[model samples]
Target: MHRTASIGLAAACLAAAGVAQTASATAPETPATYLERIAAIDDAGPAIHAVVAIAPDPAGGAQGGAQGGAQGGGPLAGRAVLVKDNIETRDMPTTAGSLALKDNATGRDAPLVARLRAAGAVILGKTNLSEWANFRGDRSSSGWSAVGGQTRNPHALDRSPCGSSSGSGAAVAAGMAWAAIGTETDGSITCPASVAGVVGFKPTVGLVSRTYIVPISASQDTAGPMTTSVADAAMLLTAMAGTDPADPATAEAGRHAVDFAAALSGASLRGVRVGVLRGQAGTTPALTAVFDKALADMKAAGAEIVDVAFKPEARMGEAEYAVLLHEFRKGIDAYLAGLPGQPPARDLAGLIAFNKAHADAELRWYGQEIFEQALAATDEAVYRKARQDARRLAGTEGIDALLARHEVDVLVAPTTSPAWPIDPLLGDHFLDIGAGSLAAIAGYPHLTVPMGAAEGLPVGLSFIAGRWDDAKVLRVGAAYETVRSARLAPPSLRRWGE
Candidate 1:
């Protein structure tokens, strides 16, 4: 079958490129050193299956040319960052973990990638993600991709890493890269980072450019940093936050952009009014214990913890899903049409047909129900109403109301429940108790920092603020980090409940 052949060809390509090389025991000193680390852990040692392709040497490759004369000697010098495969890189194929895009090597850098390169980050490689960023099927497993296989959680090899930013989260937790980029529409970044035990920051949507990255909902899709600490997240955000001529949403980014890294030095929780959303925290007793401890730590650090109430409108969920389906069809059509060369599928319809023709690979575990819904989403008036209603419920009448009514600077809650068992038959068991949805739907800033573990599985404490309040959100998270318990270290690969 074509699916099987695509997998074989991908494996052969990696083998030919010698993706894994000899690794050193000490810290990585160069880009090649990081590649060695990825090889040792991601390919041979525990085989986490995080990386999809090891970027070829940039000398003479399109990477060098695509940088547009921006030299690498900025703040990120000597650092190496892994990119989510959904984001295009000039030197590697930008497959969204789908065989249909296995040959999508567009010789151009997404403005975000170019920014990182200009800031001196070595483009390490592309990390695997949920196939089609977990948009193709309703019952699709998180982290399972036909091109790179399933990306496992480093904490417990058997648990889900949470997608579609699965590999970006796991690789950072397992120490496979200095840091990684993750794109999110809803829970993609925060969910993975929380369960994987790392920091994930989804900035105000317009703060980062969405151009050249595969889209789901342009209104909600934004690339963010998934790192080991709040400081690193700030460092990456400083370089990444800017305007791009192509992404009109970012027209106001220049006015809001600031030196995020420098703001951390003055961060403090003293006298800060923090509104708590208890309803969003998970119901498990163990998880509650962890969250309670986090609240205590914040209160001790001089934060005013005020419990708040929030209830989503009855139709908000339906409207949000409708908005995503409408946007995915429109955005993906534009993205696929703009790709260079004879790419596999030209639009959503073509992608659906391609998946049908290769169902053994693409649909072995799940059917393309979401894809069908998206393709059939043809009502412009309904989509407009849905977008307006969803944004109002999640934004003006949702997060904005909570902050205004409570007289709080920001909001807090548990990021999500700990990692669930990875079951392909049942797909992702993502619980509804979390604080990411409102921020995501509102296109506001949301951040997750590791609070502690529940039953040996890590969980995160979330910090969220109104749109363009990114610096304030980061400062609060950093201040809490200083007073919180010791950060969770990367876990060794092991069996469940070990």
Candidate 2:
């Protein structure tokens, strides 16, 4: 079938299956113009706090204005994007959703930000995130932060938006921005995107530069795109990727970077081998039903699917947690030291003290058990061993071994279960899910595409590809997205105070 026909056929199937489509009537405009629209929407009454700050220049009036007329003809000339607060932009402050660094602004843009600006994408603003990317406390709510407050899910006002990259996901879903940049150390991007009903791509470590992003762990830290469509994610990623002299890890990215949007042909998934990770199943019956339907769609699209069962050792999660705690302290210290102007928290010790001093504001709901644990573990030797073991087991023995044995291009699983009930008093009811650990431990690329709705909430099907295979992952995701046709329209209450 022709590519366009395939999309039409897929759309028809989805509509028949009860997926309603809402047409957006707005015509294409420059990125600068888009920002102006955002300001008009957000600044009015019932304003949602999705955006932390807007850039000084509104679209259309500025030199590199939002309409893509910037620098003559840049790749993302007319695209407007919201960047998560954790990713530093010289145009905005890098608060990381915390009051500790409320005034902190890096003098220069992050490498990824520089790439976006070079491609002519306008920085609409910074989106709210879980304070310190949700690494601060064991009982922290996914989307709540001391600085930005709670970001409501666009799908349901009463529901949670999920963590770390919550505002980025919500903004994209609500059409506040065409796309947004989100940083993930583990489940941050996937969880938020899954709950908000958007597409999120967590590229392999080093696939995108992490030079100015707030750190949890250098090994697992990476920035990715959260967009309404898989194709949009690919377009945003193509502009954000490439080697960065500021981050040594990006040296490995090399030619792994490619025009991901160009790889979104209809037949991209044809003859591709996909392995279903059976070990991660049995969360919710609704999710399973969606998964089955998705599998059927892929089969109709001429892709091979195999059910593979290879659960990792139980100790892997514990070991991974240990590594993150140790690395968070060290990585955060390094990041703080390099910040321009006065440092907010000079080291982990100072950060701990700052949190304690501002407990009423920062620790209103959750206690800093995770931070305390990191503070308690001062043994370097034990930390090094745990970190090494986690990487070896998760990367070499876990994900890599299973993919090689199955000979699959990607491993598929539920990005997350359904959106749990949002309870500020009790925090997130995430339970024990199979996300974060695999990708976080293995340090591989993981992408989440909207699969279907479960009880009026969104669910995402995950794609875990091998290290540095970002382009291939994007291609496969875009192809499946075309077949699934599952992107959702924002709820009626998307505008703040609605």
Poorest stretch of ten by lDDT in candidate 1: 19-28
Structure candidate 2, residue pairs in collision: 30-66, 30-67, 31-66, 31-67, 32-59, 32-66, 33-59, 46-496, 68-77, 68-78
Q: For model 2, what is the error of residue 374's alpha carbon versus the real structure, in angstroms, after optimal superposition?
A: 1.7
Question: Candidate 1, residues 159-240: lDDT per residue as tens digits?
Answer: 9999999999988887667789999999899999998888899999999999999999988999999887888898899989
Residue pairs in candidate 1 whose N, alpha carbon or C atoms collide under 3 angstroms = none
| RMSD, candidate 2, Å | 7.0
lDDT of 2 at 394: 84
Q: Which portions of model 2 miss their true places by more than 4 Å? A: 1-48, 60-71, 434-436, 485-489, 492-498
TM match of model 1 to true structure: 0.92
TM-score of each: 0.92, 0.89
The candidate maximizing TM-score is: 1
Error of 2 at 60 (Å): 5.3
lDDT of 2 by residue, 341-365 (tens): 8865888788888999998998889
For model 1, state the Cα shift of residue 410 in Å: 1.0
Best by lDDT, which number?
A: 1
The predictions' CA RMSDs to the true structure, in order, are 5.7, 7.0
